[model samples]
Target: MNVLVTGATGTVGAHVVDGLRYAPDAAVTAASRDPVTARERLDCATVGFDFTDPTTYRDAFAEIDALLLVRPPALSRVRRDIIPALSAAVGAGVEFVVFLSVIGADRNPLVPHARIESWIADSGLETTFLRASFFMQNLSTTHREEIRDGRLAVPAGDGKTSFVDARDVADVAVRALREGITGAYDLTGPDALSYAEVCAVLSATLEREVEYTDPSLPRFLVSRYRLEGDLAKAGVMAAIYTTARLGLAARVTDDVRSLLGRPPTDFRAFVRDNRTVWT
Candidate 1:
């Protein structure tokens, strides 16, 4: 099977690329905005792909059997940018699609994932939706600086989040691509943990005290705005945390284990493996 993985260098996409390397029957191509850099980094077949650029779609989807659709976080306008790309993929004769969506996206029409899911269903292509929970890697990538400084600041209140490792999510995506699995699966870690509990895990693993500030929504918005300097991006992040605060992100499931034939990686194991980032 030939597969194209969008956002190839991103959190979960990068891991997808790595996992596909071992799949003997699957030929994987990494899609990036910069194919030259992606080729150099991933050392695999790379294609230049941009969601807003229709011209790149044909070449990116050419001769592809399945697609791993991942939305770049920067692009928010789904109607203008994403829908066209999905349409192009269909036109190009792509057979199956595995969309990396978020948990609670089906019920929450406010998030872009919901609209994308709806469009894919109507597009008549075979597809699977991996509605993943909050990623544990968020601490290592998005909030790395805060963790380095020994503070975990977010607007998630005291709500627990079922955090899945990106590697686990990627493993499932690879399986879906190779086996032609179709349906919606809610992928999550073994436990739901609040930021306070997360901090404790970090402290024990890293041998340093990590504190959860439990900042309010307004404060988080201002802080994110200052950090990213983009109000729209900040607003999107605030909404995710708000979902957690409302106790909507804590649902755990056996989907990961069922699909992978193994228990999902726990938060403490993730911290132990990636402890260097915080140090």
Candidate 2:
């Protein structure tokens, strides 16, 4: 089996590359925007590919049996970039596609994630949608500076979220890539924990008191740390925080267990494993 993984340098895509390396029968190809940095680190054959360019898709799709499509974060415009890849995959006779999508995307039109989900469903290709919740890696990277400063600042108000480990998401993606599963699986951690709970876990791991501070939405919206890139970007992040505040993302599921035959890793364990990031 030949598998092509897009966004190969990303957090989840990096793990996916590692997971695919163990499958001896599979020819793994890692596609990245910057091959010099991303390709050298990966064990598989690397190719130069960018989402915005249609010409890159045809060369990458050539003789590829299945694909793992991951959307770039903070990227508000995707249809123009992704549709060409989907069409190229069809023309290349690609068998399967595994998409890393956001949770509750179908119910939230405010988010562009739903639009991508719709595009995948209507593409006339066999696909497996891995709808992942917010990633715990966000704490280690995006919120790293805040954690180092001993405070977790956010606009999410008392909102509980089921954050999953990126490794687990990669495992599921590799399984779908190799086995060809055809359904949407909502991947999440074993428990739903509030932002405060996450801070507490970090405190325990770092052995320093960490606090969760609820900053005003208006203040953050206009702050320098604003993640808003465009209309879709701003609206999507707002919907995510809104969903968290409304307790929409608090549900825990056994989809990870069903797929991997083991329970999903909890948040505390993730913190303990990556304590150096917090310190």
lDDT leader: 1
Off by over 4 Å in 1: none
**Residues forming the 10-long window of minimal summed lDDT in candidate 1:** 231-240
User: In terms of TM-score, how similar is model 2 to the real structure?
Assistant: 0.93
lDDT of 2 by residue, 101-209 (tens): 8777767766667788888788888989888888999899877987899998777799899999988999999888878788999999999999998888888889999
TM-score of each: 0.96, 0.93
Clashing pairs in 1: none
Q: Pick by TM-score: which candidate is best?
A: 1
lDDT of all the models against the reference? 0.91, 0.82
In model 2, the clashing pairs are: none
After superposition, which runs of candidate 2 have C-alpha atoms over 4 Å from their true positions? 224-235
